[model samples]
Target: MAESTQQKLVCSRAKAKSDTGSSVTQSSSAPKRKASTALPLDMKVRCVSSIPVGPLVYTSRRMQGMIIEWDEFGSEQYIELAELQSMRNSSPAFFENNWILIDDEEVLHFLHADKYYGSAKSIDDLYGILKKHPNHIAQLVKTLPDHLKKTLSIVAYREYTAGRIDSIGVIKAVERATGLSILSN
Candidate 1:
């Protein structure tokens, strides 16, 4: 009797799918997954490092360690907060020099405010900083206000005309710094 009832249900489902022109199929024994909740505000962070960081998993209020998904493989990993704290306390420069920030946008904005390198008082100073730290060109441009960008563009152009800098490097740097095209071809 139960078999007959199951056959009828399956037939009905097949009929329904045929009527709707649907190709969907699911085994009755297949496990259903629950929808995952969004991460808490504290857990979300913007990674500024050239190296990737994490989508950290919060365990519990009582736990001192947090789970970090470092790779695509499901390897269980845990890092102690105390150990990280100790490292930070031992050498603050490790964090600063590496330019790793696992914090919210506001904290990053605060850090960008004349902290790593002081603000340029003149266009020459700005150009000097950009030339010295080519790796930081993008980050420096991001931090600059519109007026500074304009000033920097003028300085870059002058340096290029004076043959003090390479045309390709100057053009690329100025475009990145000022958000404007120098030469098309």
Candidate 2:
């Protein structure tokens, strides 16, 4: 329903923050700090990237080398590592040498999979890294099935392609640097 008189100021800066006299709630219209966080205390979402890792994970079928959008809303997801490795071994396609993620809900990466596995770098920093490498980028762009390429994720690919996302290999290195877990998919 309605947010009442608060929350509206969050998107508007000047109106937020407490003045000398007012109820704490009415004056500070900004979002309160979250008491709990999934990231390290020092980390924050400096940028928001919705890069297409690949494919629509079908609720009915198992897919490989891809992150599935959970049926439930919001960002949490599952990766099927066994399916990824098996797919890599069997498919004619080549995937980025590693995978990147903030959490490990599944498996380990394969022989050549570049493990850019973390939620560490500021989104801008990571985005810069992805932009530098052509081959890695080619791999990412190609990973999308032709249909997805033609659809909305194509927009994701284009945005990243326009900006700088370091090579998948480079992001993989950062993953190792950040000490994040590597899960399957």
Candidate 3:
């Protein structure tokens, strides 16, 4: 009786194994998943500023140079934009195309080839350029530094409460709050 019971157990085990194998085979033969047409999240910024405020390389209607040292503790990067106005008096000629160079190396380029220029025409122009790349927006939203992320969340919450929680609004809010313009047309 014990022998008969052992054989029955072995037969059941074999049957179970066969059932599992068939299921595995069926799953393997199932339709494969299709790749998404959406842009990837790893898209790089047209321009990138260093953490804790290192060097700033930029091109503006007023100023164009590499600022290696500044009052990082007191002033943020956008203050550099004001420098453009002061320096613009000296540089009267408009640079139709230019590059943000650092350490004598080109970092970012600005060109005005047509109506949709390579450089931003204004704040609205910069905003418009950013609207084209959804992936870039996702990257910024996902990988913003912790402090900035908290601030972004707050901005998003405020916007949500105000019924203005939109892509452009969120981007503009972050830009206004952070004073970091990492994207260009």
Predicted structure with the largest lDDT when compared to the true one:
1
Could you tell me the TM-score of candidate 3? 0.21
Clashing pairs in 3: none
Per-residue CA lDDT of candidate 1, range 62-123, in tens?
33563333341112333343433343455444244432333333333333322432244333
Supply the TM-score for candidate 2: 0.23
Order of candidate numbers by TM-score, starting with the best: 1, 2, 3
User: Which residue window of length 10 is worst by lDDT in model 1?
Assistant: 49-58
Q: What is the lDDT of residue 146 in candidate 2?
A: 38
Question: TM-score winner among the candidates?
Answer: 1
Candidate 1: global Cα-lDDT? 0.47
Collision pairs in model 1: none
Model 3 alpha-carbon miss at residue 90, Å: 29
Q: Rate the local accuracy (lDDT) of all candidates.
A: 0.47, 0.35, 0.38
Rank all candidate structures by their lDDT, best first, as comma-separated numbers: 1, 3, 2
Query: Can you write out model 2's per-residue Cα lDDT over 110-147, one digit (the tens) per residue?
Result: 32333333322123333443454544444443443333
Q: Rate residue 97 of model 2 by lDDT.
A: 19
Q: With candidate 3 superimposed using the best TM-score fit, by how many Å does residue 176's alpha carbon deviate from the native?
A: 23
